[model samples]
Target: MMVQTGLPPMMAKVLVYLFTSDTEGLTAAELIQRLRVSPASISKAVGYLERLGLIRREREGRRRERYIVLDDIWYRTWSVSARSIQLGAGTAQDGVSVPAPPGSTSPISA
Candidate 1:
């Protein structure tokens, strides 16, 4: 399902495994062992997911870096995105309230 949304298949598969597991988190080394793939693949996938805020990386008992997906993951993403959009909208409104530049034909000019 995630693969269809521009995610690499390997990444999606790794995520599926994490989602299905009853465990709280999985380390990259553990993922590599279970997925039977090279460490690079898991590293690449985990990096991408972390950047997108879909997952978080943390130390698990000082042994390894664990990837975790909190239950409120979606809510966090949505709230951050909504706040960004709100900021953009506020900037737009400010632009609208400003007088147009001299001799300008910009859309913000009324």
Candidate 2:
């Protein structure tokens, strides 16, 4: 479902796992182990989610970063998606339709 909404598969997996997990947060190692993905994949997904404001990366001690889902994550994600849809719809409405040259049988040609 998240992928269908235009989120990449890896990011969706990381996000869903983070929100659904029993723990408060998960480190990159933990996410990699649980999701069975490469470090690079987790890094990319984490970066994407962070940029979207769905998740935050907190410094744990001096050497590790834990990724936690932000409060009201569902609402935030929905708002983001809604904004994107609205932007797309606006762009579609602003487009100029080209008419068929002549003698075209297409229903929308005019």
Candidate 3:
């Protein structure tokens, strides 16, 4: 499913696991064991999610870094992206449809 969405399957799995977990965070080693992915794969997926601002990294005292799903990660992610989408919608409404990329189309009609 994630492959169809142009995301790595492990990355999607990592996200689902994080969001569904009772704990707020997980270490890479734990994620590797739980997800049955390579250490490198865990690192890669964590990096991707961090870059997306869906997760945050916290360093323990002289220990491994932990990746946490922010309390309002989805809200935060969509809040930022929504602004961009709004700008695109405005541009489209202003007869500058070409300024917005095809992928930037809003789900709601302007």
Residue pair clashes in candidate 2: none
**Lowest lDDT block of 10, candidate 1:** 1-10
lDDT of each: 0.79, 0.91, 0.80
Flag regions of model 1 displaced more than 4 Å.
Answer: 61-63, 74-110
| Candidate 1, pairs of clashing residues | none
Summed backbone clashes in each candidate are 0, 0, 0
Tens digits of per-residue lDDT for model 3, 11-77: 7899888888887788888899998879999988999988878888999769798888888876876
Better of 1 and 2 by lDDT: 2
When 1 and 3 are scored with TM-score, the better candidate is 3
lDDT of 2 by residue, 55-93 (tens): 999999999999999999989999999999999988776
Q: In candidate 3, where is summed lDDT lowest over 10 consecutive residues?
A: 96-105
Highest TM-score scorer: 2
What TM-scores do the predictions have? 0.62, 0.84, 0.65
Give me the displacement of residue 30 in model 3, in angstroms. Answer: 0.5
Ranking by TM-score: 2, 3, 1
Residue 94 C-alpha lDDT in model 1? 89
TM-score of 3: 0.65
Query: Best candidate, lDDT-wise?
Result: 2
lDDT of 1 by residue, 16-67 (tens): 7777777888888889999999999999999877776778888868667889
